[model samples]
Target: MHRVAVLLLAPVVGFDATIAPTLFGTAAGGDGEPLYEVTTCAVEPGPVASTNGFAIVPTAGPEALDTADTVVIPGTRYPPARTGRGVEDAVAAAFARIRPGARVVSICTGAFVLAAVGRLDGRTVTTHWKYADTLRELYPAVRVDENVLFVDDGDVLTSAGLAAGIDLCLHIIRCDHGVQVATAVARHCVVPPWREGGQAQFIDRQVPAGDHAATAATRAWALAHLTEELTVHTLAEHAHMSLRTFNRRFRAETGEAPGSWIRQRRIDRARELLESRDIPVDEVARLSGLGTGGNLRHHLRRGMGMSPSSYRKVYQGA
Candidate 1:
């Protein structure tokens, strides 16, 4: 089994720290056996208080990092204003014990620890969108892109806040196993197999709810009918609203215009098909409403910096 060690720093974000073990530990192999052996560790190997006024006693100490195939550092609220100035002695020692070639992952502000240790230098990474500016200000060498939910820079991976960690975990499982296993895990966890877009889609927005949740049904219909010819006017008619009102409401509810949202959804669908299915690029494009292979290539390059074939090769593990 893959050994995963979660390093719990003081004032850790309870939700962020537990997600990996909970998700990864529950992940099963084809024969219905656990795939990962997850262990919680700390610098001192004792009860560590969380930011939520609770304490969790870890199972091991820093030495666990030495044997772990993957070392995960969850978000923590450290002292001195949580700035990425320098690594603590204990933290540095733990990092050192992480055997060379072992994957290192950070969730949310846990990127701060990696940044402090100079592990993120010259690497593209991301943290919580709220802390993206701070990370940039502190580490000028790191290419910090706050738009995506996570950055998987080979051995080193960093995810945005909270739930983005789940996405990262799912992506890792997909990378390690395959789409089937990851999709099964997502279904068991009662979450979507994949989110629609990058972290940018989740930026704070005042979305209407209940009866005032205008355009929600139309959006759902559009998602289900991605291959259909969908324009702003069509969506407006589906929502029983004027084109101008629909556009305004779409921006208000989704934090983007209707065309942009539809484009992203199409791109997302295309990516899903590319990763999970063995279909021709032209067929995938037609099914995703991109119309043609050239259109699909253009959008994939612009949105993901990769062609459909390249994305399939990388993500499908083929």
Candidate 2:
């Protein structure tokens, strides 16, 4: 089993702290064995206060990080981390204990801790949207993009606030295991299986008056009919709006252009088919509305840097 060490620095964001363990711990293999061993550790083990008006007692200290395959730092209110002054001596020592080459992850304001330790320098990362400006100002070396739900930069990954932590954890599970396992974990946890990392973060937006003027129904319809050619014009017609009006409304709601969103959905469908079915590449492309095997290859290579066969081999172990 992969070992995961969650390092808590009080006062932590209670919700963010639980996301990794909840999602990773719930993940099991075909034989019903846990896929990961999750341990909650602290700089000084014992009672750690949370920002949520509660405290948690951890069973281990920084030593847990030494053998971890991944080290996760959840949101923390530690002054040095939050202010970019530098990490506390204990926290710095704890980070040093992480095995070389182990993946490093941050949830919400926990990016601050990573940034303070220079782990995020020159790397694109994200935190809560409200704190984007502050983070950028504090650490100009780190490129902060608060618009996305998370930024996955190979070895280091950072997620946006609270609920977005769930998204990132689910994403990690999918990457490590496969779509089926990730989807099963999400089902067990009662959350959506996946959200694209590039998908925009939820910000306040003016809702359409009612069902009549909203693009939600049209979006749902498009998802159900992904095997069909879905063009912006067709979507506009289905929504009973002009092309320009539909485009404006769709972008406003989804933070992506209509054509882009359609293509992404088709790509997502193709990936699911590749992982779950034993069909030929051409057939998968046709079923996913990508037109041809060449088109599927093009999209997969451009977006994921891999061909369909490679993806299948990796996920299906075939």
Candidate 3:
């Protein structure tokens, strides 16, 4: 059986801590045997206070890391005030015990701990999108792609928030088992088996209900005419500004390129069409501004690592 050893830090998010075990343990092989054996290990064997004021007593300590097939770090409240001082020492000792080829994972702000160890150096990684900017600022060596739900750089995987942890665990199950097994685990958990990491984190935003919404109107305008095959030139024209000026201010506010933002909007539209209607694939291409079925397939595979039909099957939510 595959062994998943999770390192439980002080103040751990309890839900994220249980994700791997609950998801992986539910999967079965052809012989009907469980595929993974999950163990929760802490720096110490005794009780530790959780963020929610609950207490946890893990089964094993750092020594168990020496034999783990996989090592996961679940999110916890970050340091400076909320955390105990032993965090650094405990985590360091645990890191030292992990052997090679053992996969490493981080859920939510646990990316901070992984970053602290420098294991994520020069790797494409992400945390909660709200904290993405701060994580990038703190760990300059990390590539820091903030838009996706998670970044899977082979052995090292990092996810965004509590729910995204479920996604990553299911992904691991799929990689270790297959789509069929992962689907079963997701059904057990009552979650979508797969979601495009490229899917927008959130869209709805609220102002103070007083200040004149500037970018809000601009964003709406961009979404209306996605199929027009426009550029920053057309966008700047709508916003009534020169190209150079628009580019600077747009990046300052949205933190993404004009082209990328448009493409993402188009993809979201494509997903909506794919899920809600029986529209043919080529129509999906045209409506989503991807131009043709072949182009749509290419973008879907590159951005999400899945075919359109497969994506619809899981996330259609219909």
Candidate 4:
């Protein structure tokens, strides 16, 4: 069984900490047995007060994280008082004990603690959009993203505010096991089994309750032909707009040019090929429609700041 330790701080946002056991508890292993063993731990040993009116009694303390297969930090209603100074020291010490290759996660403002300890240094991460700017100011080494619901930077993961915790935990299940197990877990929770895109994917479109976007038919049609040669002309044709008008509408909806959107997706696809297969660079380039490895290398570096081999090594390490 995977032992998951959720590190709860004083004045904790009770909901974010609970998201772990609530989601991880639903996972079943091969042959259908329970898969994960989860524990709630406090920064200190006794009862820790929550942002909610009530408080919780943790079974263990920071030391509990020493043996955790995965350690997660959940947001607190008050990030500073509880997670500042001494609290930060305790959290860092606990993190130091984590076994190599063990996973670490943060929910909402809890990412501040992870970043404080340098876990997210040189990494792309997200928090509640409201706090994105503060996170960047405080931790200049961390790349704060204001968009996505969550970010999976290998073993270290982070999520957006409040209910996005559910999505982050679901993603963890998917990462540890496979899509099937996570889909089952999501089914049990009665949430969407899968989300379609990253934070950028949701930016221009109006997402319904708990979803990321409401992309119109134009986008729906565009997805069917991502790998083929596509252009602004073709997209304008599909949307039935003249070039100038279509460009304006697309920008208003998605916050980027049509060509830029396509390239982002193509680069995302190219990374998948690099990480998932041993195919030659030429095939990956061809598949992503970048035409050549040199172009792929240039764009990949521009977007992620790492070469294909380096990205594969870092990501595949997990």
Every model: Cα RMSD to truth: 4.0, 1.7, 7.9, 6.4
Total backbone collisions for each predicted model:
0, 0, 0, 1
Over 1-318, each residue of candidate 2 has an lDDT whose tens digit, in order, gives 799999999999999889988999999887788999999999995799999999988768999999999999999888887787998788888888888899999999999999999999999999999899999999999999999999999999999999899999998988887777888899999988877777788847776788888899999999999888788889999999999999988887777899888898888788878988999999999998898999999999998789999999887731
How does candidate 2 score on lDDT?
0.89
Q: Which candidate model has the greater lDDT, 1 or 3?
A: 1
Model 3 lDDT tens row, 66-109: 99988998887748212223246666877989999999999888
How does model 4 fare in lDDT? 0.76
* Model 1 regions lying over 4 Å from their true place: 143-148, 201-213, 242-318
lDDT of each: 0.84, 0.89, 0.76, 0.76
lDDT winner among the candidates? 2
In model 1, which residue pairs have backbone atoms overlapping below 3 Å? none
Worst 10 residues of 2 by lDDT: 199-208
Question: Across residues 139-250, which tens digit of lDDT does each residue of candidate 1 receive?
Answer: 8888888887888888999998999899888878766765666777899889866653243526465546554448889989999999998999999999988998889777
The alpha-carbon root-mean-square deviation between model 1 and the true structure, to one decimal in Å, is 4.0
> What is the clash count of model 3?
0
Which scores better on TM-score, 2 or 3? 2
Which ten-residue region of model 3 has the weakest summed lDDT? 78-87
TM-score for candidate 4, please give it.
0.65
How many clashes does the backbone of model 1 have? Answer: 0
- Can you give the TM-score per candidate against the true fold? 0.76, 0.95, 0.64, 0.65
- Of the candidates shown, which would achieve the greatest TM-score relative to the real structure? 2
